[model samples]
Target: MDNKIVVITGGSSGIGRALCNCFIDAGYKVAIASRSVEILEKVKSDLRSEGHEILTVKTDVRVDNDCKNLVDKVIEKYGKIDVFINNAGITWYESNEDGINIKKHKEIMDTNHFGTVQCTKYALPHLLKSKGSLVGVCSIAGEVGLPNRSAYSASKFAMNGFLNSLRVQYLNKGLQVLITYVGYTSTNIRKIVKDDSKSSHFPPGYGDAVKEKGMMTPAEAATHIFNGVKKRKRSVRSSAVGQLTVWLNKLFPRLNDKLAAKYYS
Candidate 1:
């Protein structure tokens, strides 16, 4: 869709960055929003050098005003939004053995779940006007909880439910709501902790274990997202494992729980 505008949250790095490139290559006008102004400018400059023009907005999705301003800026720039991808999210890898870190849980929920809700609330009007798509870059954890990711899973589960409900609510309104279940990918999301003074609570050698297991690249995940949007697909899974996990959980939830525990452990 040449010149069709797509607004993405958390578009500075990782899958978000790759999504910018993918959409640009496909001839869409991409607008990205993130909390980091420096990273936003860098990504904008880098893309500008490649002859692709994009709009960047400094947005903290947890803030209602910021989310509203993000949509306002994109509409001001492009006249309309053809798609809005709620991709901004954070996770905590702490275990329940230490008791839930209520503070960290709130932070993750604010970023991942409430962030999606706020953005969607602001973007829905424009999306409805354009008969556009609303996409959530959710996770397999949303479908099946994993060990040591209680907060993250809860956030995604909330996101999944919210988006799914919107999908049905607007089914007769020519709106497309897509929920993408992303599997383990080679992204820095896991290693990042909300408090820079502390380190992630992942078990020792977790990085090495991830490396040994292998994961999808951000580009691969972006490609899947782009294709899903292009096709107006209701849902997509970034990895076959994620797809299987959703199905297995549907049929044999208890067995899937054991499998999830073993995989994460």
Candidate 2:
């Protein structure tokens, strides 16, 4: 991985942060972007001490300009981009009872769906220049609708559709596009759960403990992602459980629906 230029968004925390550490250890020059400059800076500082080239950029994926700036900065500094990972995302706890909280739903769409679109669009040219790979960390949620997370599921579903179309278009260019179906990962996203009471339409349950039981650690998830990128795989599903979820959803949609309803309840 030495001398390879890799850009990861939402790199300040969770799976993204773990990827930063792994790639750096493999001798790659890595640039991490996120809305949190403080954490990014700390990550950069820590990696630099080990003689790894690291760049941290504060970015809000909701902004097109920020995405452009991220890619531009990477190119200006490294001369070429070998891989682009669109990992920035947000998730909310909703039960579908009163319908999704309009504000939170919009926020999820803006950050997870639209934000990914913006970053992918901006990075396309740079990636094309090097015939680089593009990766999106979608979820098993993308494969099937969950009971409580209407908007979050919809956004991920949309990401899958959009990236699939993009992959076909880029295939002829000798560029690879990979999207992953990640089950659970020990990420700060669960710890930061938003209270739906503030937004009455939203569901009430917080997912902190639930996620702890179902997901792998961020480091474990990062390892799957690293191997996927290194192999230039068309798609990477993080674990057997995640892949099984997709298959079960496809074969027994109603069964899973009932099970999910009970699980959420």
Number of the predicted model whose lDDT against the real structure is largest: 1
Give the per-residue lDDT of model 1 (tens digit) for 130-184: 9999999999889888887888999999999999999999999999999999987
RMSD to the true structure for each prediction, in A, is 2.4, 2.9
**Candidate 1 — worst ten consecutive residues by lDDT sum?**
203-212
Steric clash count of candidate 1 = 0
Model 1, runs deviating above 4 Å = 194-213
RMSD, candidate 2, Å: 2.9
Could you say which candidate leads in TM-score? 1
What would the per-residue lDDT of candidate 2 be over residues 132-210, giving only the tens digit for each residue?
A: 8898999888887876778779899999999999989877897889898887776777666653343322223435644
Number of backbone collisions per candidate: 0, 0
Reference-based lDDT, residue 206, model 1: 46
Question: How far does residue 186 in candidate 2 sit from its true spot (Å)?
Answer: 0.8
TM-scores of all candidate predictions against the true structure: 0.93, 0.90
